[model samples]
Target chain A: MKTPGEQKDRTWILAAPGVGYLTVLYALPLGLLLLASFRLPEAFSISAYVDFFGDPFNWYIIWNTLRSALLTTAFCLLIGYPAAFALAWSKGWLQALFLVSLILPLSVGIVVKAFAWTIVLRSDGVLNQALMALGFTDEPVRLIFTETGLIFGAVNVFVPFMIMPVYSVIRLLDPRLAEAARTLGAGPLYVFWKIILPLTVPGIIAGIAFVFSLALAMYVIPTLLVGERFMTLSQQIARSYLYLRNETLGSTVAVVLLVFSLIVIVASQWLAGKVRANT
Target chain B: MTVLERLARLAVWTIGLAVCVYLMVPLFVTVAVSFSASPVFDLPPPSWSLRWYEALGSKRGFLPSLSLSVQIALISTGISLVLGTLTAIAVVKGRFPGRTAISTFVVSPLMMPGLVIGIALLQFLREIGYRDAYTGLILGHVIVTLPFIMRTVQASLSLFDFTLIDAARTLGLSYPKAVVKVLVPVLSPAYLSSGLFAFLASMDNYPISIFLTDARNKTLPIQVLEYLEVRPDPTIAAISSLLILLTIIVLVISDRLVGLRRMTDF
Candidate 1:
């Protein structure tokens, strides 16, 4: 084998490029954002944070973003958990089929998917036609250009994120635990409620964190579906940069978003650790 | 199984099938609308036709944008492959200080929203006087796509036995030579799969590209967005359908070569 000294030297050489890029691009930009957020418009001050927190409109936008994100996460959890469990339990071609189906939409462009939702949820779209034909309503339901439309699109896009993590965990779980529970005279419902649910909590929490962070930062769906009327924090930041040309304020808002995301990530990481320790 | 259990199973199947349909409907509808004879955005095309596809083929900027997207994707993927593979090797085999911190930093872009990265890079590029150019776009794409390539390569390397490389070195092959002749040949599938993923991530990206692109050197997704803004036309649908077709063809070929399922484990 090669000398340890040579291998050590070669390893550092290989490591340099990636570490350099990450340091400059990912870590450095984030540092710049954090630093810029603190810089005052006219002089060195914390005015950006003060202005962001002082404005009721900005607070409303932040609230709206969190509300929508939470709703989307809840919906995904409700639907995705069962679907993922079923997929995990499935055998042979069915499992492959489900996995492929989940991954296909993920590869499709997010903007394109948002556009597709626009087509389906429009006043004269497919849903309206079906509703009218089914004698549900004569007038088209106002599905598009609403919060409901926005949430629907968000959940649709992010459900796979929820499903995949939970599926990963569930797939690795031993089936015999549930089988043993049943054999010991436990009802199916009881076994699932007591054992399966608790064991899967980690995955559910992970999925929630993943989907929630994504939902909080979503721009395209809200932009396309809800338009400018229902402004999210991200859309507002985009407006500041592109429309208002307020780079400082725009950077401030982006910094806020980044901070909010970090809080969620840190919180979830802590919760995940606690769960692991408890188990 | 009891009747109740059977009914529950059937219900599960129904819901699963419905969710699948919900997911697939958009693509199906896009393809259907693209083939419609009319230019309107109505559901259920009155008569089927290939006029939109013909129109799309004849469009002036479409081909150029497609080619540019491919070129950018290829270059970005190449950069990511070399950088990501080396990084993965380093992380897995090297005893570097702050290795965890380095890994987290490298993969952090994957967790950040694309829009954030796009806007940050745009501002950064402006400061550096590289605004609205191909170089800026490629640099931004490499930063974002590098994480995906690195993650996959790391996964592949985790399963790789370093003993083979050691054995090759024992046979008098130089360090770089051993990596080239022994390590890479075995890891070629991971490289190819990760490269394809990186390409898709670059080609399909719009949020980041939107901030970076200008009037002259726009990517296809941005072009499609602009086209949609002007009017809702079947040409956009036609182009999207073609992209969908291309993705399917890529997946099929990949599946035939190396199973797609294994690629997803990363």
Candidate 2:
């Protein structure tokens, strides 16, 4: 029989390929990016950070990224939270259909989905056509290349992320808890506020963090739906490298964006763990 | 029940159905436009026709990129499945510390923004003097697809009955052979579900692939975007419908192998 040391080594060896690959590829590159943002090839410098923050346009970019992501997360929750209840209470084939509808759109490529939105949101597009036909407007209203259109397409893409998590939590939820609370003279609002809402908070946080992170970093949806006339951090990174050939600027913005995403993700994970422990 | 209760419940269902229709609007619109007889995008199409789907055949840059996308997806997802499964097994079965951290590290790519990863990889590749677009794309896609397989397979592994392996081992089978016999069957369905998810994520990926690809080696999404820039037409809708159909087929297969609801649990 192998020694305990040998057994441990053998077991850990199985993970080397994946862990080593990520370290070499993902972690190493991102580490390099973070390093690149702060230091020059020769010595350390804060010039990139200063230059980035010094620019009013860069502030606009950061604000733009945060605002869009916040709005996207808010809208997703507004639509998706109730839908989770609807989906969970649904029966048999209806449940399956709801799940399929959610997953199917998610499966559709972001490009195609964004492309589809352009068709709907363009001045002469389907949305305008329907709106005019329904007498909501006499002429085509501009939506493509607008902020409203960008958020609309993003929420459509990301609402599933919100719904699926909250739905899972709701699925495991004890309906009897709410029922019992109701019997004890608790109104529906009170039951929801005291029990159901508190229980689902973890799922809501996960969904919000996820959608926010994605919306904050999304490159495709904004680029397609709103066009490059508007700039988010992702677009700024792409433009810096692709158009301006400015790696330093690109890396700096990327690091900033990455920091925001990591903060949200790590915090949610910790919050979820804490919530699980408390319950 | 009070009318307030009934009213609230009705409101929930109404919003739920509205949200469902909202989620599906882009899809329905795209499919409708694909069958559009008109040259430009219009709802109800003026009349139904197959011109756009036919147009896909002769559309420049469509076929090459379509084939490229499929190839990259298959190759990268295959790698992620093999690598991710091994990683999942280690994380599940090993008594090592920081297993959770390692698992999270591997799966973190799925949650992070694609574009940042793209730029980071681009810079890293250039630093290493990597000049080939195809290899770069393969590496980038592996990063993108690995997380799907890892998350799904890890969930399955944690729930797996490892004691069965011990029972197989006690029956005069070798350790490796026992693991194979007992684990493979239960894991196969997970493989199908996660593998489909990984494949679709890779196939649909645009931001990361955009950085890795050259003009001649663009993925389908990038190619389609460029085409849309050059010529906005229903042919784009035609390609999208085909992709949507592909997703449906994948969904049906996954639903058959393992119930769709279970896939979501991971």
Candidate 3:
């Protein structure tokens, strides 16, 4: 076998091509984003940043974007945790059924899912028809073009993001840990709270980071579901770029979204570090 | 089981099965609606008809965008597979300073939102005066897909036996040839699943593709959304159903080639 030093020396050769491409494509583009935000039509200035912050409407939308994203993340966790636990604990065909059911939805396009939800959530749609038939409501409830509908769509679209990470972590847990807790007179809830919860914090953190970031940046769902009535930061960015033709404004919005996502990434990493230190 | 334990298990199964049903319903609705004889989307089709599927054929811009999407996905996935495999080898086997940093950087695109990357590329391309839509799209998709390939290959490589390469080398095969003979076969499952997943990811990509697409070069998702805006009917559903069928085929083949768990255990 080659010495560690020799192997290390050879790594640059293997890694250079990929790293160089990413630097040129990924890093440079982000740099351009930063620059575009600062450099306005006239000259290099923070006028766009000033303009963005000056508008309280913009602030509300940013806050709204984050709030909706948080709600989506919370819903994903609430639903996904139990489902993930079940998947982790199950065996054979039951597990296979759940896996296929979940993965198949995820593999399909977000556009397709968004389109599908529109069909189901429309005023005269399937859900409304079902509700009326079941005597829940006399008329079609206003689900489409509503925040509730968007959240429902976001959760349906993103719950898998939560489940996959949590399931991966939970599946690796030794069954003996739970069994030992049970033998010590701990109830199921107690065992989960004291043992499984602590162990799975990393996955939970990762899932939140992922779902939150994705929900924050999601353009397709909001565009298809709520449109201009409920403008997200992502929608605003796309609008400023494509519709408004204001590149500076779009870049400013993109920077804010990017910062929020970066914060999620860093927070997850920090939380994971803390979790590792505790164990 | 205790009564409470039984109730808890029942609740878990109920929630799990409910979640599964919730996930499947939308796609089911779309497919069902596509078969409806009515002009509008309706669940439990009034009568089964292939009209919408046939409508997909005459839909202007549908075939061209679909072809463009397929072309970009294939090209980008191929590039990512080669580059990602090389990078994974380095990350998994190389012992270098800042290796962790490099690995993180390689996977960083996955964490970043597609819109940010899309907008960033839009500005970057404008600055560089590189206005070719096709080139910009392939590059953007490469960014979108590299992480999946790298992660899967790295995972696969960790379980691979390097001694097989040594054995082949001792049997008079050259070093490169030994890797081709031994390592490639061992890692084929990773290649298969990642390639398939990456291809699907690229095909489904919208946010990134949106910014890069020119007037004539829209990706399939963009085209579908545009078409949906102008014409609200079962034709989009027909396209979606076909895409869903494609996704199912990909999943089944990947599951058969390598357990879905191996692909999904993230």
Candidate 4:
């Protein structure tokens, strides 16, 4: 029942709880991570960084992490782009159905999805059963306990992330440009490759950044599907903290992961900016 | 048309549909396995039954975890709604300095890896001597869920007209009165949808919650993970199917409250 000015003031005051909560919970924790990254461990030493960067095994872990993430992103894009395009170009009811189908799996828990994949990819899983029935393979294949299974689950979980962004961009794209390219004697392939692909680069970049970061930090799916033999950096960190009871090493590994993520984010932002300027 | 061209289109559609099937197959299998008359995880269920759902009722650990998850999700959603709505108003309406940076910082948690957040929070909490506590878990969940609410509220605020507010002011209504009378009603759908999203995000969260949860305070996702580690049971499928049904219910309610199409961008 207050005046407009009073209402505005009240609303601002009401917003304080959320703002303060975020500042304390989110901003402070991030600040602590940054601070912990730089602090000297026991007697003013740079040992954490040295150990993280100087070790070959650590470097291999980093390399494997990036490799897995890149593979996941690449596969998601290869599968998602056409799926997104088909969904975007489809009629109204079909588009709605496709979009719902694409996103429904996302609502399932990450652990649940990973479990589902285990059931499908195990030696006696549905996939092997299907293949055997179809005479594609005479024996059960080792799929679940490998990098292939990890990537499979990662891409399956992340494809929706990839599809949503690209679909948004594709939905907003000027269809006339494609038509003009075709009218100007370009074939369907050329129009797709030249016009549509370039226009959706922002979305592509966004999707890649999203999927890469997610796949990098992924723990549940890798643990459940790929198991311990092929440990990602995240699993290594978890093992360090929970199993090995090594907080310092876990913190060090976490900081390294944070740095890698920031680099990817910064690089993506730069690329997006350049693309925006050029377009 | 050449064989290759016809084959190429066919292959593309085939792959597309295959991927779709791949996405849905696991979920359908989980649901099917949950209702299986047999208790084993291998092969298709010989017959369908309601035994797993009945077993879910007797599982002492499962219900506690389910209740804990629901409680945490509700609390987190309630907090997020209040904070997210207010923050959205301030970000959209306030003439504050560094507004853009502040807005970005508020939502930046969305981009960061959940495991990194969990680990960082664990370390941070340990340093401050607050490790493995409900307060820590709540804070972590809030940080993770804030962006969804903020984004949705921001979108709704952007779509809102300022002229009505100004006119209400001119007509001698207080700011609070105007907002309560006009703005709240207008943004209610956005607020509700965002709240539902925040709830789901909190409920399904595992990485962040795993670090913060003590033995006494396990969430449903963590419980599911722990149980699966020991034995792969049809009860896990039952629990998953229940969660899926919950999601569908939320979706249906949300659709009724605010058309599902409006929530698509997020």
True contacts preserved, each candidate? 0.33, 0.75, 0.64, 0.45
Which candidate has the top score in lDDT?
Answer: 2
| Model 3 C-alpha lDDT per residue in residues B136-187, reported as the tens digit of each score | 9999999989988887788889888778888999999999999899989888
Name the top TM-score candidate. 3
- Between candidates 2 and 3, name the one with more favorable lDDT: 2
Model 4 Cα lDDT, one tens digit per residue, A195-278:
978999998998888888888888898899877888678888889888998877787888778777878777877898899999
Off by over 4 Å in 3: A1-8, A40-44
- Residue-level lDDT of model 3, residues A162-197, one tens digit each, is 998898888879989989888889998798789989
Regions of candidate 2 where Cα sits further than 4 Å from its true position: A1-10, A135-140
Query: Lowest summed lDDT over 10 consecutive residues: which window, candidate 4 chain B?
Result: B1-10
* Top candidate (DockQ): 2
Residues A1-279, candidate 1, lDDT per residue (tens digit)?
557666434576787987887677666666776777777333577888898899999989999999999999999988888787677767667776776677666556776778888989999999999999999999999988999999888988888778877877887788899889878998767877899888998989879988998898888789889988887888988899888999778888898888778787778768987999999
**Looking at candidate 4, what is the lDDT of residue A104?**
66
Instruction: Assess each model's interface with DockQ, reporting 2 decimals per model.
Output: 0.49, 0.70, 0.69, 0.47
Interface RMSD values for all candidates:
2.5, 1.8, 1.6, 3.2
Q: Using Cα atoms with residue i matched to residue i, what is each candidate's TM-score against the true structure?
A: 0.91, 0.94, 0.95, 0.90
Candidate 4: tens digits of C-alpha lDDT, residues B215-251: 8899999999998998768998998898888777777
Predicted candidate 2 versus true structure: per-residue lDDT over A12-100, tens digit per residue: 78899999999998988988889888885668999999998999998998898999999999999998999999998888887787877
RMSD of 1: 3.1
Each prediction's whole-model lDDT (CA): 0.80, 0.87, 0.86, 0.80
